[model samples]
Target: MLKLSEYTHNQAQVESHYLYKSLCKWAAKQPHATFIVEAETERKLSYAQALAAVHELRKAFGPAPRRLLLALPSGIANALVWLSALTGGHQLIPFPAGARNEEKARIAHRYTPELLLTEQPEEAEGFGLAQARVMTLAACEALIKQAASLEAMEPLPGQVWLTTSGTTGEPKGVVLNEQQISWTAEQVRLSHQLTPQDHGLTVLPFFHVNAPVVSLCSSLLAGSTVVIARRFSRSHFWSWIKRYQVTWASIVPTIVAMLLETEKPAFLPGKLRFMRTGAAALPIPDLLTFEVRFGIPVIETYGLSEAASQVVANPLPPSKRKPGSAGRPVGISLRICQPRTDETADLCDVRAGETGEICIAGPSLIRAYQHNASATAFQDGWFRTGDLGYVDKDGYLFIKGRLREVIIRGGENIAPREIEEVLLSHPLVREAAAVGRPDPIYGEQVVAYVVVKTRWSTQLAQELHQYAAQRLSQPKVPVDFIALDTLPKNPTGKLERRLLRAREQARFTAQDVASHTA
Candidate 1:
């Protein structure tokens, strides 16, 4: 394995080159290299065909619009539009295709994009956008045929706008320019030791940074092929892996757990080097169990939409991979800092090994949120992440929990992850979430919600509580344990703790009213 200093220095070179231009250059040189394979249709596009398709799509655009709103599903068409929008010099905002109508309206009203692209043109009314400004998949396909063949055009600089997962409040729009996007992709390619022989499997939505920057763009930078799936189908996941001969895959922790729950395939397909999991905190037990059960190592990574998907990842093999850590900062600078609050912008003062806010700065990180400068304050180019963690002596990053997710009990600050991790170690607990519930006595008390593999029962809840009691201190143990078939998760499969707290509060209010009447 290369030394950390050597890796950082080598990756520094990739920032100078634009990813879109490099992709085009590589495509023209290696025209015959397989670039994309659509698993649903068993369709494939070689680099030559992909380049031609992108050119056709660009020509279809005619004049580059100021902003393009994309709500296309995962497939070859969506991939083409993404490349075309970036290369043709148009600001792009790709909304998750499965987003709710209200969510779509919120963005459309805010941005008022010049063009809205979707798989279903009839649904354009839902966004309250003019029909004339909307282009359906059919329209894009028709334009592709009418597009005139032309020489390779110079790549243009454009911005890609993305929204935070909105797990807490209204999602904030994050903006990244072409250079930032491409540089981040190159960083991922270099960090993962990607090669032309590699094949990436992407089931993540196009709206997420992981799909575009981590999987597709990184594969392009490495001169590798990517298999695009319409949606994540656990039943067909392993089969597709076998069919496509996939080398590695980009997935979230939820998908990883689901795949593990599914029965094992008779024979695992391809020479799957590793599976990269991120976008949410992965339970340490799940990470270790996956490696033990599937024999494919799970490379845990950490990043945000603002950083263009990956800022750090566990190096590909033969190197030390700390199971619980998010690995070292790759092609970026990281710092542990004193926690910042909403009222003030202060410099970080934490030392190494001291728990604090995880802060980062790099070419890949966006300096500002779109139209929301007040949301973030940068100190010495470092963006305070709001995530809490500390770097170990060996430099691996360990996440404690989100600062907002921290629970306070009788003025004692507690990270929910610490208790959640202990609860998840129970064999019956498939998923667990710990949050603070309003309490008159303690200001706030710990409460837990869990999803069990077996049937829900009072006996089971008691067993889980007793198990947690054995592992956790008196105040750390949950005051209540609620068993559910499944916990509430957002579109990205992250547990919604805020919503859980709200629901629990409402339920308690209702209980109080009933008791007063009785």
Candidate 2:
């Protein structure tokens, strides 16, 4: 029978002892095991080679811990640094090689590390920034000829910091501790069923907790080979999967939708055993289409950076995979909280019928936002998820939508996801976005921006509006629809609603003036 896995962890394992030092624990038993297969060049690293490389660097780092920002290709060297950072006992900030100069500078300054680890180990010429002792992967390689016995250095192991996309504000660091990392990895391993036999593929950026902790750490701890993508490319996805024989991978909804289209998939490696998707709500229609084509399950899950990356993942058994739901809570307990004048209270069994804010509490949940003191807390020390959903009688959790996303019109509330989903059903629509524009009389107006498919024409827009009107209620039908070749998208490929809103407001203002003059 399935039950919540214990999250109990000993800090000594992931934190107190250096990262690479304990990596030796996992490696000693399987020194010859292959741990990495570089995605770009197909170079493989056995456990012994990986361990030896890290040991060489550990000796060079010397007594005092160095703040090493990991910068290398997504291959053996990259994998070695990651293990070395943890086991070798350095405070690690894994930097993405492809990050923009501005983003790189911003993050580097924020971490304030003493040393920068990169493939090109040199003092950068024009950074105009604080100088960190630059050490390249090449420099570390040269030191191998004159290595001395190096003891692992344990770090001041708290607070592994992560940053948000900063779409809202200058990204505040999301701090995590060693217990959080080790505990979260263990929970995710059991939740995702990651094991040595599982061939994992990672396209998510290592900078994010979802990829680093959930995908990378979870897989490695289970002794699985993770195929790391230097960067995520829709065109390269199928080829990488086929080449790596990836059994499991994680993706957001955008990539899944692209893969679901009726073109011949570039199935370079063939199909994965299953896909785990999260970070945003996935549309159900595309979800169904993807499952049918791939012949593998798309396991929708719920997670947050605050909660160590994963909370609820759909279990693997065919019977357990629900087409629309994000599946059940995995390695954690979920509850719906009844909103009160003062605070929200947990409704764990929630009668299996009503909607409420989906709140989760478990060892994986963050103690609190790194330094955000003004935060909402519900009963049992659970963070208010700001999301509304309910579990059905069958225990399948269905996310209605985010609380902030619900729109109000004529004193009635409407979910934009529902409207967007309906609009997306129109064959002429290639992509759709719904936003509430400020209105004088109605308080808020529902507006949609659409991208038409190549085969479709301007006439299809009218047909789509009519199509939505017939199926959806009056308030739900968009009052104004604008056609675009494409919508602004975020780095992760999710539609940038905040940008779309600015555009919508501009159009609305222009229309109002034109109407007044006419």
Candidate 3:
């Protein structure tokens, strides 16, 4: 049996340049150990079986390395296809299964992948790819089964092509190499202290960088088991945990908020260890309420696609944890830098407790964006995260908000998070978002959108306005409160503040036109 300490020590000594080597080592040592589970179908795959499957699936792509675009949903098949690409040294471009054909077509045209792999070949009709370039999973599986003998080839490192969430603007392509992926997986494994005994659950989509690095690759390196769900289901979340004996789960703030609204399980699973939250800012009130109600610790984390996933994560247990903090940098060098007007100038570090742009440089981070998009983000060997945050005296990071998302009201700069946090503190508020609206006098004024538990009315909006005023400064108070059935969010459950800003701008423009007509 591999003890936790022994596994940790072994992981430290192993070379992490090639993830395929590590997978092969695990298959050789623990051939029969379970590796992954399909939560919906309850199908299991062992390490040895997974390796064999990878070898078989690699044959479909031929011996030559090519860029393969995968548009499959989250499941065991998607995991296997990803592993095949990684081990076979083929670059994999993953697109969301639920994305519209037009969106997928735009990505395909931009990247120009050599092959397109999807569950339904019909969906690729308008992708502008030839029929020979399109390959369905079923067809690939059939080819694998028919092949009498697989060709012997050395497993080489591969790359992952991803894009930013594009909440602020157009998404840019990010390419992560094998070493970067392996490095991030090792860092995540070390931070979480995962071992062969642990079982993880992944509800985040496979296409997102979070699932592949934080859940799949990390678990693979640890020789642990992970349950891959089709999607996040509030009704079945607890049931899956109890049935699979899951110890940890990787989720976003949206999932946490939704889970809080649902009825608590009658009895919490004893084997479950913690819930990891990332990809967005989680309201402190919701975090506290979740811990108090469920008796499970929520480990808040911070990461971006360019970093290959996790850059900071809170310590698990038996250590001092500061709520609302993204913990400390793990396997990376992080510094808060003062904003500069010139893009070519050097960036100076900000003093502790002062908010500035969060910058990171590490082995896990990408050097540049694909197609040279957003070149300004990388400078002086550091990737400016474009997020405003500060490191405490104790070295914990507190994220304020996005640097681009700041609201300037009459020359007073305000962080939207401050207003949103105050609004979220209200019992009636379910979700809150703040954006800057165009103002004739102040240039930009603070506006808030909120989802309430009860009905929304003019009186309710007035009450929220007064509630916010008490907790915020005069300038920080929202000039207008708009009740929404729900806040606009991206596919990954991140609030799309840019969409809100656009909506406000459109409304203000319409009103201005009406006034002129009158």
Candidate 4:
């Protein structure tokens, strides 16, 4: 998570506005223009229809919440509510629909939302709220439809409250204002060269910042179209792209790997341009394999909830793109700074090609976490990204690993991503995550969790270790490789290093105790 700063002076001068108004304006100009479509049902909505639907949903919310909890599955209905909430001057807090009831209750209690909206009303009951307080998508749509009218209020830029991906630890709510959100969308539109003629397929969930700001909001802002899928289906991914004539899509590395694993299609989609992958460090082998297998370039991007969505991205075409780099800063000024030890102390910048904590200062960056400022550190107007990376001479950023995820073995810091990347290069390895285990002799030992295509065996493990050794330093090779059917990942497909470390500690402690007793 990045420690954000106050909005820049230029950001304050920027005309920060809501997407709802933009949608309405687009609807009036092009009533028949398609805005979104359901890939499975083929149900579609033009700009006019979508605006009307959003208005109807907005009218049903008797009174808007200071903060509204969105806990619906991915769909047009979910999008409508989100747009309505943003335009209606309500703070938005999105909850993952797949979360357990207890988890939902915990988040609900922490955020203390005035309204809980979901497609499944039964799920809202977990929050212990009255039924009347919980609104369903169908129920919101069932409201009486009045003539479509746009009511202008004193410009109150709505704030979008987001949670950290919680991939490595507990999630925290980050607050982003309208300027930040709008700037991010515009950056994505400009950086990707989006236009009204273009169409995007969105397989990412609506609850995340990338889906809304990058895929949906950016498309709408550019007067383009987006197709929303309920969930990512590797089998149907290519078919959806071809059917919708989707030019590009926002995706994660997990989906890319799955697509590579599936049998290649007879031919690529005619109109498909490229696939954008982010939210995790893309293994170089997978990136090259994906491009070779599909005949489409994989544009690696870098973003976080704190930055709204996009901070950097590989250019689409006619521009050189490094295989493993996240590309140059698109709409932000990035710097490599010595890791901050105190919030009040100023940190010096690292030289080019020097690995240090990545930091950023830009219009799109968030101002602060919802209510927790102590959790992050900001210095000299730059927010520490907590990610360890370096910039090449070409100004391309290469992420090494996360600050918290670094493995300190015998006082020498080893980036887990370097080890994971080496293991993933192996033909048999499908998924890989590296964690540090406590070692009395060396302080910590490197261990890897791998999901292999073939049956796990000691010989296979030895082969992987040898392969890693040839590429990585001797100290970087994993002491033990545990084969699992799958590695645990957060909903956004980010490897959960903390969980793996915890599991390793538990197992190691038990073994140590048993040996002492014996």
Candidate 5:
């Protein structure tokens, strides 16, 4: 058991607001309590040992409070470095460890951080950064082995710099203070009803905000244990859950689909409570099937990097969890508002059950993008999420799609998710994506790309077209059905509609050239 003091030097303190400070208090009360476990090596770090490691790594960072960029894989070393930087009062900028050299260099040049940390010394060359600014994880570990004197420094709350997914364009940086992170972590802890006995398994990449705030920080505030995996592995996923007796895991829809397509384990891990899915919408059919097949409930969630990860999540069993809804807002003020076209006009909230732009405001939300104070997303203290959704009379949120993603065929607007749901309901369709293609008569026409369970054929496309026509209106029906082995997705498993739209445009361009030449 760990004990946290009610007051620090006669001043009242909120334990959850400062994570590293709570960690130090936990170490003082119970030195040997388990805190983090490395899934690959089964390495356990007690509270006392974790604090010592943080201090040892801080020496390498020195006493300067500068921005530190970390480009390392998810593991014990990466966790320690992150803790070291945060507790030492340094700002953190995390880049994906598996990103291409071009991407790494682009981020490095864009942010111009004071220090760059990586796993290998040569990585600095690839990132186009000077070697003097680079610090390798191996070097940090060697320094820890030396066991130098520990320095006493006050735990200072600093900003955490993160970037958007860059799905539409270049990724923009998001700045979050420690207080915001603490608020979101507490929301996750309360939504899931986490306790000290709960054991969380983290499979999402550490570069993303989900892994750190949703998984690590939430578990820390709950006084629970967390097992960190390098990445999501379908082959080793179930085995790890059984081996560690994992109570819950945070995952994406891509992982959910992969698990359903693959074979199941010989026996289910009874200790596992549920799987939390977010970052992208999970088709309703897949969500129900996953629950029925595995005998485990799938909790659907909605979040983004701007909000520090989770905003809304379906409650656990016996709580009236809706199947396709992202549940209600947790610890935040959520409303649907008319899309802002005129900057001077007052923002108006939409009535319940009316589709509009989703907006959020709370302690967990970021004020503005880093280096982008004039960004239009922040208006009157509310962050416009750019997502189109509606709240039911009961308060459950139903996402339609992005405002930019809506297809306007002639005069009517169409939601891609509506067509996607109908396609996924077909027994033969395994995966589906809907996008708008340019048209001569109508402004834009609906096109669908699907991955079938069996071989593709001309008749199969016709069959799918017929199936959608029966379920959808004439204007909403897909004019073209394209067969694909797999739909394009981002690294985090979000469907890339922009790529599909580009493919359609190129196809039409080539066809026009052929017709003119002939």
Candidate 6:
């Protein structure tokens, strides 16, 4: 995750504050605005009821651990508690409501919470429940049934904590204080000039700050209505856009591709003001197609969990909005820092047009992790963003790609060496380089370019898939396999994955082969 300092100086003045206080302030101002609505569900809340529920929650769980896990959908009740949890003096830890029952239990054990709020009581993982209370959506309503209950307390400054990708390597928890999150939201509101007339349709998981802080919080702060979808579905994307009159939304490249591949919705929603893509680079093709179809600007952005990053965004109004350039530093400054040999030495910034590691420091950025002392994101004051991008003479920042040597398959991370080592063990396989290729559903799926001495068979593909599936998660398994007669390498014999990927994809098309038959 990129640190906020690696980017700007405007961040130095960020004051200490808590998120709960922000909610209270917003609720005090506009208590009648609609906060959230779950798709297909009649259940929802106006800002007034949302404030009431949040106040009840604060009273129920007084000052305690600053971390709280919100295992609920992106509905009205969920949104209310989500704000309450963060503003109620806790970090909201959200997880995908997938089949991973044990993982939820594990998190409950790992981050002991003062409260574990969910819509399902029976779903609570076995451990960490004795002391931690279980309050479902129905129970939350019951609290109101008794009487108007409100909790009063000063907000816990520096209370926000969010998680980014950590499937295998040490899970790094990106910690940001309440003030940083609020400021970032405020900046977006000002920079974009968004107003209550806009209604945001947020489908990204709320656990991640991307959905909450970026899309939802920004909308609410502007008094704009927000329509929350529990999960993203390409089938219903445009329908929801039209249904809710969604003006703004943030999406990942993978979802954008899905929309492109699927039949264009009956009609593009006219109310969509803008769309932002982040969490990964927007594919060139997907970016162009989306705008052509929707007639809306497809803005791009750069952000990280730590440092409250939100480094840059597409330019607005009269300025020509570049399609690929993440645009100049929005609400922040970005510079590439060349690492020096000295351990304690400060890094130097590279000249514009020069390629180096992107370094950032800003008000939106955070200094450290929550209870995690092992994080090495900071150097001097700037945070090292493990991304390799360059700025043009126009001062526009364009990200080339990730500096992290991990394969992204379908928006999932898989260490390359892990797949390489596994494939090399096969008796017929000679060598391998696992790289990612663009896919409609998965953003990028793993493709292995291989050199083999023996004949390849479908059995081999199944065997490799099974091999990796047992040892690693499903996302790490290569969806596409390339078998080559010889290794195409440099004179020094280093395998050229870029060349191999081109060759492999070319052969598949040349052969006119349909997707590998089962």
Top of the candidates by lDDT:
3
Off by over 4 Å in 4: 1-14, 143-156, 165-168, 341-344, 405-518
Model 5 C-alpha lDDT per residue in residues 1-518, reported as the tens digit of each score: 10111100111123543778666767776767777888888988776777777777776787757778888888777777767776677888887664556456667777777788888877777667664388887876676555434334577776788866322333567887777777788888888988878889988778778888888888877778888999878889888889888999988776787788767788788888999988767778889988888888999988877888888888889888898898878777787888777656556877657898888887788888887787777888988887889887677888887655666554234668767878999999999888888664354689999999999999999999898877666766898999899999999998888899889888878888998999
lDDT-best of 2 and 5: 5
Ranking by lDDT: 3, 1, 5, 4, 6, 2
lDDT of 3 by residue, 84-202 (tens): 88778889998777455545666778878888878887877757777448888677656544544333358777788986632233456789887888888888898898999989999
Q: How many residue pairs clash in each candidate?
A: 0, 10, 0, 0, 0, 19
- The collision pairs in model 3 are none
Candidate 6 regions off by >4 Å?
Answer: 1-22, 99-102, 105-109, 126-131, 141-153, 165-169, 262-269, 339-346, 370-375, 407-441, 446-518
| TM-score leaderboard ranking | 6, 1, 3, 4, 5, 2
TM-scores of the candidates in the order shown: 0.76, 0.68, 0.76, 0.75, 0.75, 0.78
Model 1, 176-230: lDDT tens per residue? 8778888888888888889999989988878767888888888888889999998
Q: Candidate 5 has what TM-score?
A: 0.75
Per-residue error for 78 in candidate 4, Å, reads: 0.9
TM-score head-to-head 3 vs 4, winner:
3
Q: Global lDDT for candidate 2? A: 0.65
lDDT of 1 at 81: 83
CA lDDT scores, all candidates in order:
0.77, 0.65, 0.79, 0.76, 0.77, 0.67
* Candidate 1 TM-score versus the reference: 0.76
Residue pairs of candidate 5 with colliding backbone atoms: none
- Candidate 2: stretches off by over 4 Å: 1-22, 60-66, 71-73, 98-105, 119-128, 140-159, 165-170, 261-271, 339-352, 377-380, 404-518
Candidate 3: regions farther than 4 A off: 1-17, 140-152, 165-168, 405-518
Measured by TM-score, the strongest candidate is 6
Residue 135 of candidate 5: its Cα lDDT? 83
lDDT of 2 by residue, 1-518 (tens): 11212221121223444334335655676766767776777766655566666677766665435676666656556655565565545677766564444445555667777667676644332223466677776776565434433333343343456654211222344666666676677766776667677778776666567777777677667877777777667777777778778888877775676566546564534436788887766777777777777766788887766677777667776556777687776656677655433534334434446887777776656665545544444345666666778776666678886545545453334567667877888877888988878664354688888887764555766787788887665666898788888889988997788787777678779999999999
lDDT string, candidate 4, 370-433, tens digits: 6766555555566777888988777788998776666656434466765776688899999999
RMSD after CA superposition, every candidate: 12.0, 12.4, 12.5, 12.0, 13.0, 5.9
